[model samples]
Target chain A: MAAEQGIDPIHQFRIEPIIPIHIGGLDLSFTNSSLFMVIVLGLACALMILGTSGNALVPGKIQSAAEMSYEFVGNMIKQTAGTEGMRFFPFVFALFMFVIFSNIVGLVPYSFAVTSQIVVTFALAILVIAVVIIYGVMRHGTHFLKLFVPSGVSPLLLPFIVLIEVISFVARPISLSVRLFANMLAGHITLKVFGAFVASLLGAGAFAVIAPLPLAMTVILTGFELLVAVLQAYVFAILTCVYLNDAIHPGH
Target chain B: MATTETAGTEAPGAPHEAAFPPFDPGTFSSTLVWLALTFGALYFIMKRVALPRVEGILQTRGDKIRGDLGAAFKMREEANQAAAAYEKTLAEAKAGSQALAQETRTRVKTEQDAKRKALESELNEKLMTAETLIADKKASAMASVGQIANEAASAIVQHITGKPADMTAIAAAIAAAKV
Candidate 1:
């Protein structure tokens, strides 16, 4: 009862500006979220650049990780969008590393979750869709519009089907961004609530006997959240490749 | 952009005073800028350096594996060729030895036949000489036996008549008795 009153699950999500900067009617202040992005950037780059520095035919641990990640993303793109989609491998790989590192880093005790923000995920999602749209238009010209025109549809339902397809296409970014943001947001909030339960239980004097239950649940949820972290990164990357596939082969 | 002042005002510790941190549209510019910069750096590094190096390493490893496999197959083929050669040599040696044995057997049989023929002809010559010597000795012994018998008869006549016997008459009587 006391834990529920004292718990502020939403407090962890507050994005405080680490270094405030205002320029030309823009508050482009560097926040905790930006710092984590840089951290993810460093980690991904370092792993790719330095881990492969040895260029070992028989790889060490770090090199194995780098090569495995490369092959994993390579195969994922190849499978989703075919070999022609390999052009977007770097883009998809960068996205995957950024998102996965963002998620994994956020799992640390006091780290900021960058992908948990709507703006951040939305930006990534919009970037993916922008590429798809630009490439589809440039490559296929007027034929790219055939994506919304499903085959075997009757004339009566064609307009309604086209409208629905367009709506879904427009909603892709929103859904993609919201899925990531909400998952991280909800999982962390739930973890915090359970942790608060343990803390409150430990403080409740007589109720301390049952504190281990919530602590155990938090541990289990952390593992589950770790899975979710990796899974979300995979989903985000594969979806990007799939959309790019649509661009590369628009008829399907 | 107009809400920059409002968000800047909310930049303090009490961020929730105005809006939930994520939904606050004012922070978009900052976050997007950072995303673009970091993501752009990652892409540049990946495209220029990381991906190519890994691809090269993979390519080298693949070539090495194929080379090693080819070498193994070549060695096996050489071994098979060597084994075949060895088998051929062994068969040739076996045939050669058999021919040598057959040649030795035939030569030894021919030598034995010559030696046996020489011994048989020499034995036949020796047998003929021995038979001639035995016949001459038997003829001489028979002449001596006749002389002894004539002497005994002369001596007996001398004792009975108290007179010498005649040699020519005796010889004539002996010849008549022999007939």
Candidate 2:
């Protein structure tokens, strides 16, 4: 019961560098966040390789899981971005697997959550938006700006509508990154707070009998957080696809 | 006591630092670098290895299914053709058997008519012989009946006269009586 003097819930989010490396006066040191990322990459790659290694017509469990994940992302892209969008299937699949793996791996006790950090999520969102903008311009030329202009609008309100559209368009990456970060951050914090409550109660001697309440709550919250973890990743990937759809099709 | 001391030492360090380290800009560059590196690596793996293998497996499975369905359809058509051929042969056999039965029936009828005609002619010949024999028998019986009548008439004449009747007279009387 180290919770005798209360617990610091924010301590879990701290970035402590594992290997300190400096280049050109910049701290490019590998941190706990980076370590977890490497672990996720290894796990993701291992799952795909081992699962598909057999490539049996009648699939084993691992192969089934691997194929199911492949179809899931493939279908998501096909539905949101159409068949033409399948060209980006690898990128979207990577983003989805990385986010989901990062979120799930973070659920392990004492593990650092990569997605909980704003910088990591923001970088991903920016990558998606940057691809969308670059490809939209290349494919659709100047007509890509039509994304801001609504069809069948009165000339009187056209400028106003365009302005609103532009603002929302610019806000895409911010909202995309923030939504994932906030959900993961909030869920983990709530879980920690409840865990600390249980610990504090257990340390209170006579009040120890009621410790099961917060403990039960923490267990339930953990289950809920797991769902949120997978769901937030899906949301991020789906929004990326939708944004890419605008790039490919523009306007409508 | 240890937890309290650690918490106290950490509480005085930052008055204006953001409550969440994620909001702190100090580690942004490093986080970005790692994200780019890991994501790029994962993307490369997905593109190079994982997806193509899965896609190949799916394509093979799809082709197998289509091939099986096509083979099944072809087999069904072959079965249908075989059944049709069997039915046609059955019908042809039935018609051949029917024609053979009809020919046999007509031949048998003609043979029976010829035999009946020959048998009727033979019976007619036998009936004619029987009629001739009956006519001969009737003539002999008539001759016997005439002789018996003459003898009885002569005996009765002799008894009444109490003398022998003359041959010539008797003969003449018998002849006149016969006439």
Q: What are the candidates' interface root-mean-square deviations? A: 4.1, 8.8
Residues B44-104, candidate 2, lDDT per residue (tens digit)?
A: 9989999899888888888999999999999999999999999999999999999999999
TM-score of chain A of each: 0.96, 0.97
Query: Please, what are the lDDT tens digits per residue for candidate 1 over residues A1-252?
Result: 223346777777777689988776666688888898889989988898899999898999998899999999999999999999999988899889989999999998778888998877887888889899999999999899999998899999999999999999999988888999999999999998998899889999999999999999999999999999999999999999999999999865
Q: Write down the lDDT of every candidate, Cα atoms only.
A: 0.86, 0.84
- Model 1, B89-162: lDDT tens digits are 99999999999999999999999999999998898889888888788888888788679768976887777878
TM agreement with the true structure for every prediction:
0.87, 0.81
Per-residue lDDT of A1-252 in model 2, one digit per residue for the tens? 123325878878877789977665555679888899899999899888778898788788888888998999989999999999998999899999999999999888788889999878877888889899999999999999999998999999999999999999999999999999999999889988998888889989999999999999999999999999999999999999999999999887
TM-score between model 2 and native? 0.81
Recovery fraction of native interface contacts for candidate 2: 0.62
